[model samples]
Target: MFAIAAPSASAATACAKTTDPATPAAPSPGKPCWVDITPYPFGTDGLPVDTSSLGCPAVNAEKDRGYQSQCYLRVTSMAFRAWNRGLAATTRFQINPSPPPTPFGVWLFNGTRWYPDPTFPGASTCYGDTVVWAGKLDYWLIGGSLTGSGVPTVCRYDGSSFAWQPLEIPAETRVKVLSPEIASVRAGACYAWDDCWFFGPEGVRLHWDGTKLNDDTPDISSPSLRGRFGSAAARVDADGHRIGVAVRWTSHSSQDGVKPEDQVRPDPGESAPAQLLRSDGGAFAPFPFTPPTVPGPDDPWRTNLVAVDLDPSGRGWVAGNTVGAGNLQITGRILPGRQAAPVVPFALSGRAACTPSATAFTYAPTSSGLPDGQSSYIWNSLSVFPDSGDALAGGTERPAVGGTSRNDNGYAEPVLTRVGCAGAVTETRFREPDPTTNDAAVAPANYRGSLDAVAANAANDAWAATSSGSAIGGGIPTGVDQRFYQRPHLYRLTDTAKPAATAGDDVEDRPFEVVADPPIFVEDAPPPEPPPAPDEPPVITTVPTKPKRVKQKPSIYSPKVSKPRRIKGNRYVMVVTFRVRRPVTVGVQALRKNKVVSRSGLKRFKGKRGTLKLEITRKHWPTRVRFYTRSGSTR
Candidate 1:
């Protein structure tokens, strides 16, 4: 969108002969015109300069307005350089003559403008920290070591500003030189910043209760048992009480002689099965089920748990990559009760065509418009919507068809996998616009980069951030300059509205249906038409006989229900297991207090047997289930 106008003598000269009614009268020749820039230039200050004509709309003219104007300008390289150079010669515009280098810290958006962490004295020290956890009411806890002293520190944000929270490190951990840097945090619903837990290297655990940090490391039976905690997620109730907490714990050893920075990498032969610690507003303990295995024997370098998240209903999800196999997988389970299901493969689609070779992963369009190769994903973040149990995993994907090379030689596009509450998986890939086009407007798309993080709120509004460059193990295209993609980008997704019914349209809103095979019959002859006419039998030469029919047995049988488990406040989850001789439509409803409060609308099952989970929110727990099949219903 770089359409620069010819340089004019003044603003008045640029707008002198506009025919459009919206155009305002030209301003005085010496006056500066207000300009609103897009694709925000983070390192530069916004200032109007005497330069090229933008042919801006007259609606932006402030003839009668006091200050703010509607003049808009898309930021281009030329315009940015001009604005920066003008800052040095002018005194009226108070802006930095030279912007500082990009800081190694997170960026904050205040709806209108972006502020780097360096702008805040309390937050600047925590720059380059890897762990950031969001809390209620826009509160955030950023964990890192003090800038110079290396003392572990955590800065708390109270919506507007940040203040460092005091810490009380345990003597044993300090003496061991365990580092104890905060690596994960889970904020529970409590007064102010109270009732939150901080986890870090060497199993360091601290609880903040608004006043002080308490060393609250859980005690395991085995003295030598230690692990590096990576991610911690929690679900809270309407009353601000913690319902459950799930943390990712990877096996580690202090005696391994690994440096603090390298502690996350397990020693040779030290990788263990994926472990998850759970808490019920109390001390953390091992979850009952085994989490999906992330590291294989051949590729032990894979992180144990890349990301973990909990839905509002307390269901937990774990996701990570399998480097050896070049696959990304995710698993979910109802917390503290159900068994962790096997890693479910993403139902991938919308893949771009690419050709796989030893040195290159190149897109090769097919005549039929079909993709040419398989795609592989590398997950970076996972988030579950608090209101809906839907989850989204964000990362980059590249073609992985038949290449033997481990290096990412192909162009990678941001990809997202969404898991719905109804147990459906969908994958989406966002490819930047083609840069070969001659249009200048399409040129900016070349700088768009890899998606790194994603988050969704209770409103189901989602936002994702992209880093400016290729991901780890990823590479830039052969002919592109790296500097052009230095700035990161953010994107937001709004939910789509459902289509309304049209007038006079008789659309049937029917649920899933299963039709059983027609029944077989064994016919029986009528007894000689009865004494039909016993009196008239002598006169009747012949009599016709009708047949009786009998119905055959059904193919579906043997249904079982599990005990109802309470999730939170009157909400319970119950599972039903059944076996069918053939595929059928299955539905379930919970009977609570002689009332059917919830139902799992009919769903088609292709397998001969499976389990259906039903959730109900009522005062009384369900005692039994009413299972439905196409053939009939069962208790």
Candidate 2:
């Protein structure tokens, strides 16, 4: 669990004050800033866990415009690594007596502040869960129980509150599977909230249609297929259809060793014949496309599909690593209608130069032992913007040096590849400022980890989640406990390409900090109005005769309510009408014995303010109807 302290208003005011107060400051429009808001000491309770998923709403969308620059990071596990050697007596580990019952945590940012979700419903006590943005103020949580011995729990947020959805898992498979491991969750392309899909290992697929869950598992008769990973873009086509893609493969690891508690990673022995499944608003089926092949020998098991994403135009992007001959990073696009494009090899040129050091390890030539530079560039996560076909691939890049052995040292840095719509690729490698230096422009320190997850909004702004720790083979110094060296980190890349705001610019060169203190721009005051001229006798003119004043009635009128119409089990819809002269918020309440019991929540009505009709849905029938507005009420 993590706790976030709200940034104080005083601190914001102090940062907004200009250093040179005599001169007005010019706005630095489209200036990019990287804010490092990593929680100190890792998890508040125990060791920090890797972020499992990242999601964000389209910042440019009309509905999400108010939630400027937002992203959600979900962490659902604990880190436990066994070091081979003992540490010095001075180094001690903070060990928890037991893991928390509900270890799932969701963190969010709202342009100004980053904080954890206080009202997350974690009744399942499950170790595996994911949160995905459905729509405005709506998100879906899907995963299995903590012990992986029961049916998965599905919860949803309905704008105002959270509730457990009545997801009906298949009765036959529920007992046999024990716990289902959900690998990916996506909001339905056509209906974000009303329709959603959950995918898991072995081709398990479940669909929720706003009411009950339906088993949409595709017919995968092959026993060799062990895992199925898939992703869908949130864009709907002209025909109101959403497209998605999935990869089914067999892992080299034994079934008994594959535990639900373990984080999802590409197994060394994993092999796929490049088989892909496509979803077109229905159950997934085999597609006629061939993924990028490994260059070495013609071995089916040599290539592994690590991540897949579909853009709004139904273009599919796949990222994976090939192990044969020499390790190679591969990425390519699948055009609409199952058309496979040329494989785009990840370019190592034009990347930030890596720092050479004694502790640096060379990129390994094979995946047999530890992952070295050879596999460093393989993307672990992929995110494609729905509005723009632009995509981002998160992985590690060892630009420090190229060698055959782990002893050949070079620092590894987290890398992000931006794949443009026109097939152009740009790479950004992150390096943190040296902590010992007061000047940020000095030599930087190596960021020794991979970006495990990444998300992008429609504005092209992106966020990446990684951890700060010693990389394997980046030899840890004596007396330093490896367990205490790692901490979860988050980085935000603001898109300065959007139109400049009318307000004052962001805090000048605000440096990244451990705390979540967002730059608060100062709003420029309106120019003073000029004084009326007094030199010309005030321009005296005859005034027209005034009409008599007429008193008007109140703008809000009483509501006309209709009887509740039962639609389904315990659900009913009631219609209410309100007459008003101006726009106002309307609310409905269910009452018993003159006491309010249930509320429909206030909904704003702004348009031609006459008679406004509203449909309120409730679970139970009310004895009396109470309709009210901000100004008036009617029972």
Candidate 3:
């Protein structure tokens, strides 16, 4: 039977890189992450040096909207040192070096050709923690000087060119939960599900700042106000002592953000929904009137958060993709715990109207002849087998700038024998390589770059980076547009025959293969899903069987308006004339000293066309006529 486990994609990597799932095995000792996955960088200066020896792009792809662009950058270290001499290739346009001199550049790996990331080379990207930034910290660093402040964007990696591309999605766009980072010294973490994060009437733009979240991006309308924001964060600790912090923005906040259950209305037999319940670290009785709003209703702001402590008691932080009952959500560990009972505090919903309508995926790397089982740099979580599958996972240190291949046509797999998670290093891979397709939007090959991703397990390692190469090996979807399709794929480091399991670790030239579960885990009780977005309101296709009100319009002239409208007319009778439409509002005033001379008996009118005969006009005539509307406009 073709078995599909009902587990998070992370949980499926148990037997990753192994042909047989029935038995537990171990992969050969692997090297550091940098050695397993290959990447290249293009700087603002030019091409970088190449030490990986994985030949550079054979040809440079074109630059266009439909086609990819081209550019170059200098190569830096992948846990070691940077190199020189490489190529920039892609179909996105121009592979310009990102401002502030990013060591990591993006590449598109086409089968026979290589395409540099022609678009914004490094200004701003969704790729999270994996990539190295100036701070040496692992959070998703975003500092491309295109502030739109009418001034040149400022950044540290300035090689002259400092232009930021316009934002594709407009502001006021709600960001649900952006799971962008969790950086440590050892393994890194990040993930993006536009389906999960893109949300709300106002799109979100929350980001993490290593320790706390800095959600308050200047509002376009306000510019200085730091509003409620969404982001990701994590802190590292070993044996109880704090090491570092990891934080990220999953997707801003949920599109249809969190709301109190409509105040509950006391549920008749139930206690007052507002009645607070109490606990020590939890809620207090009657849930103090901590009104979600501050000061007043017009306050217009509130902030929500999701954070992590990498050093859990047993279970590590839990992060992954989850869906069921038409509701989808992205969950992250809030409290630091262990692999068994890690904190699963917060979750983002997928019911947003901004669900991912299209998707693109890469090859479903099959372990086949590779090692049986092993944890990867990305999957070294505490879970024995996060996933119930046979596979290994990994990410590359360099940007993907060559051809794509699933087979192992190389030298030695990584050689780091000490297989374990670290304080500074926390390992993690992507949700899935399943192609999420969209035609107009060239299917993105998510080798989201090392900053964004790259993990390696003993059995197999996987990396997602910009590629201009055609997919290799197997598992690509049928009838895909290979001509311009530089696809994404997972690669398992093939294993060498082991001698025995007597060694302390599965690595160190061992005999019996060491098998571990997949890299991800989710709670048994499903997480909460956000409400549907407001954009795509429910569609009512069918016509109503019963008749309904159709059209109605008000007349222009009225009996009272025939003559010059008088302000003070018949006392008890409003002699002014106006027509009545569906339902409208209008304000009339006797202008005096540039102010409306409203009297105690100012009469309120109901229709658009009315004969206003006031009883007390204070012996004055009306000055001006004005129209108002309840529907957000002036008539």
Best of the candidates, TM-score: 2
RMSD of each: 28.9, 22.6, 29.0
In model 3, the Cα lDDT at residue 99 comes to: 31
TM-score of predicted model 3?
0.23
Residue 456 deviation, candidate 1, in Å?
1.0
lDDT for each residue of candidate 3 in 485-527, tens digit (9 for 90 to 100)? 2322232223332211111211111111223335566669766
Top candidate, metric lDDT: 2
lDDT tens per residue, model 2, 177-206: 323443223222223555666666555666
Q: lDDT values of the candidates?
A: 0.41, 0.43, 0.25
lDDT of 2 at 253: 24
- Please provide, for model 1 over 1-635, each residue's C-alpha lDDT reduced to its tens digit, 9 standing for 90 to 100: 11222212221222221112443343332331112122322322222221233532322222221111122111110000111011000001111253232232333433233333333343334332333333332233333434455555555543312233434355444444344443333222222334566666556666666556667664433322345665666666556656444444344431222333433333244344324566667666655334343333332333345466665346555554332212222222111211112222211012221111121111222233222364545565677665555666776555443222221233454556666655566555433322333232121221223455666553323455554432221214444332222233344343221111111211212122234456679899777555434343346556777778887555456878776555455556666777877677778877766677777767777777766777766565666678766675655
lDDT of 1: 0.41
Candidate 1 residue 181 C-alpha distance from true site, Å: 7.5
Between prediction 2 and prediction 3, the one with superior TM-score is 2
| TM-score: model 1 vs. ground truth | 0.46
